[model samples]
Target: MSVTDQHGNIFSIFNDLLKADYGIWLWEPYTEQLYFNSHYLTMLGYSNAEFPYNIATWKALLHPDDANNIVPMQFKIIGSAEYGESFDTRFRMKTKNGDYMWVLSRGFVVCRDEHGKAIRLAGIHIDTDTSEAIVNKLAIQHERMRFALDTARDGLWDWSPATGEVYFSPRYVEMCGYQPEEFPQRVESWIERVHPDDIEATVTKQLEFVNNPEMGDTFECVYRFLAADGSYKWILGRGKVTRRDAEGKAIRIVGLHTDITELRNTQESLAHLINHDTLTGLYSRFYFDEKSRQLKEKHYPLSIIYGDMDGLKLINDNLGHATGDTLLKTAASLILQGTRGSDIVARTGGDEFTLLLLNCSGNAANLILERIQAAIDIYNTTPDVLPVFISFGLVCANENNTSVNKLVSQADKNMMNTKLKNHPENLAIIRAWIEKRLGSEIDIADTRLAQVHSSS
Candidate 1:
């Protein structure tokens, strides 16, 4: 008294009643004839009166490639012993206007003869063209997305909160020094691999993303990942919540992981350049000033010693600038060796350097300066080059007397005095003597400028 379609869709009830109100098409096996519901005819862009209205009538509407398969499948169904069983097939249907569209035809036998054989078959047919079109379009889109992801060279990760499952693409596993199966499933598995120092903050920030959903997109940070070989590498992780539940909780997170090792190295190199002298690899004048200021603020007693290479200009002019550079580096080495580990020595200018000794008195400064001078004396004894020497001036600063500018000026004045004491002639006197001796050979810049002006 009741019958249902193959997919459990109800069709007819109470032997005399037709339950299907929508368009449906059926074929009578005994007569090899076809009947279409109004809706089924319209689905094929046709009306009952305009169509062939027969079994062969529907074949013309099928796509050329699908016609062979659909016909064979129909024949198989009709010849089978299960006469009340339905048949399903998908093929292109020709409309009244001659346009073809994809459609799925499915139905079950509803009528039988007294001999228990199917005399007529009846069932409901749905317009499955829209669904098939959607499926095909989605398949194309998925393939395009796969190609993009494969070629991008970026690591991708997805996590499902409800299932506690994490999915990583092949590239993502490669970034963390692991094969796909080696990756752990829980969030802690990821957190555990982060460097210890960054682990707590990184974990806390991630939890905050869950607590405040608005911050989910901001959960980007740099952390160290433990490599397969037990070395740690730097990577940057950036993510966004791709799916959320009805409760506003994040159900899925999708993100990228980039190797930022090179970036972090570049940052460190830049910082070193900012804080260090390029030539001698010592602290620069800028760093010297900053460190001194910090020491002063901390109320530490600071002793500064200023020193200059003796005859540096003479070495440059006579022996060449290369010799002069070597002399400067030699002097810096002696200064570094003579001072305590806590002391800071910096090359502030050409042939000029200073040392800041923490908790050092005038006596310690004098001793360190004498040691540097002695080291220079020994270096000067090398057979190929002339003997090199350095002159120094020492100044001690306490809470009452210390300011970076004042301390430097005081040491500089003393350095000049020491220079004069050693050579008995200041730079002015030496310059005058050189000019007197080389007067005829010298091309005076002032006279040259004057002559150029007159010519103009």
Candidate 2:
């Protein structure tokens, strides 16, 4: 029969069997002609009247990447009887909207010439773009997850409650100091390595989380793990319950373990630096303020002794800041030695120190001042280049009510008064003593006197 007559009969059969959801097409091999049913043209956002149904039009719509292989494969499959009477392939085809849609094309040779060369071919095209997009997206996601797990050196683990089976990635094996084959893939492998002291509580918490889905999907904890080196290392364990039973019990868990020993050590060092003075190794001003606030709420018998070095500027100006620093260090040591262990001593400023004496009255504070003086005298007798002298003022909290900050201010004012009264005379004596020892006249410009004159 003629090609048009053959197509009319084929269309009659398709009209009875094909649904509106499918796109049907026909091709004549000898003429290289193509025809698209109304559904096929409309599916591509075009009407049958608008689109020219021809081989050239169909080939132009094929995506460049798929055209080279799909076009050849389609012809080969129809021409060779040994291969198959029908063929199925997927490729991108352009839509009238100017975007490509994935199409699953299944074609069969419906007619053959006397020489057995296929004469008429028929096919149905189905839009599988959404499914293909989802599949490609999942493949990319899996590859990204693998790259992140490998490059971050993060250990990954999977646990199945039903089988009591555990899967450990290669990095997880190395994290625990074991080869992949050396470690058994069982839940107990991980449980056994948890430090004895922490395992019970950790497991208890894990069970609680599994039983209560409302708590959250995430589980995180920091605990010590026994390493292969026979030492305990701090680990930050993080995980999510990925699968759960109908009753909300966790059935599958995925997790990561990160070594956090260095991070923990850094945090502790930072805390220490925040609470103590780096130079004097004493409680810092920040710590002192916090302690004082706590003590103020109690209204206990507290005495604050505010002390200032008598000639620190003169020592720094004449001998150098190194000598001034030595003087400060010596004074700090003396204060620490004289104060009770329970007392809080802090270097609150460049030339000032404060001692917080708990459960101490004015009389007790006086005795502590005497002890500080005696300690300084002993230090001076040790043949030091510069004798250390500290002027002190002590104030006690009122029995009725007084804030610690108020007492601190009163004591500081008293200390300043005492310093102004005795500092000039004390400085002269110290300078003369230093000069006598060195057998020379040391010209030390008194910045304190200069400040007084300038202010006047």
Candidate 3:
């Protein structure tokens, strides 16, 4: 309906009451006589005739910013009366105490002549402070929502099933590195980007809720989405089915989409640490133990090799701990490279490493051990602080007759024997190697060693 028809209905309903929360007045351009209800006079701190009674008088009471609009609208209502055009606008008008408050004014030309000219204008005013207060409240709520979305690194979206329209707030598009308008405005755009593995399952879950309408149908899931940059990002989607039609069909869904890429990355990293060693980046002892148990149960023949860096302590004391760590990692890498993909390598303890070889016989284990020794010899020839060599002890076992602890103990004994055979010449050489590899540069005197022995 036109503004004229709307205002006419309002005036017709309340004109007889002569009592509106807002002021009501009519001005005759020719006579300049203004007729105002008691409320109108009260608005200006005047009783009937107590003030100059005309359009000029009322204009003086308008708020400064509203005067410009009020003047033009007044003339429009007067001029457009023959066409039944009316004016409905909101402006600030001065109150009896000279304080200005918002008012909604609707004016119509009620009396028109045969020439289609306007003779008299009738209008009503409603104090819109209550309505204005409501609007301001909504505006504040909108601002708070905007702040929450911005600061929490969250995105928001609205989907209308009936129209097949999807609206994404700026944050939603920006998170995926796209302009707001660049993305398609359909649910298909969202569904098509979900990771293939998760898409069907996620859709099934969503459709279940859609088909069976529930007041609190909260759908939540995490899935990968193809970003505008062509990289896939993990997103945590949470939504509520907000609108359902009379037939109980879902018509709209509104919710938030948060980029959980970083969170997923952190989870993957933690998972890796849980199963793998932090230092050597090999399967951890826990993983080895679990896998060994499974392998034994499955009756798989496995060769277990336990090794320790032969001169780690000497190297650590002579060089630095950093060098010692480098040597350990280097040895671990070589051991890993020598093993088959099916085998597991682990850093079992400080200066100790272990390996589990699947389907490998004792002869095969020996061959691998020789290869590891050869790799160490080659590594030592490099100019950088040569990685101290590793000494390995192997125990071959199968489900027929095997014990993990017994095999490990046998390997440990062999490692001890190997270390003894390769011991450096003098205590000074041992101490020097330890200092250099272990970040400690202290040299112990023979007198101090004698003192320690005597004290013991």
**Candidate models: Cα lDDT each:** 0.63, 0.73, 0.66
Give the clash count for each candidate: 1, 0, 24
Candidate 2 lDDT by residue in tens digits, 328-435: 888899988889899999988888899998888889988998899899888778764568888898998746377778888899878877777778788887898767
| Residue pairs of candidate 1 with colliding backbone atoms | 61-94
Highest lDDT: which candidate? 2
- Rank all candidate structures by their lDDT, best first, as comma-separated numbers: 2, 3, 1
Report the candidate with higher TM-score, 1 versus 3: 3
Candidate 1 local distance difference test against the native:
0.63
* lDDT score, candidate 3: 0.66
lDDT of residue 310 for candidate 2:
81
Residue range 148-232, candidate 3, lDDT tens digits: 3233354667777778788776667788998756776678777887888887767667767776775345566778898998999
TM-score of 1: 0.50
Superposed model 1: Cα runs more than 4 Å off: 1-153, 159-164, 176-178, 181-189, 200-217, 227-232, 239-254, 290-296, 358-386, 400-402, 423-456
Error of 3 at 349 (Å): 1.5
In model 3, what lDDT does residue 149 have?
A: 28
Q: Measured by C-alpha RMSD in angstroms, how accurate is candidate 2? A: 21.9
User: Candidate 2 has which clashing residue pairs, if any?
Assistant: none
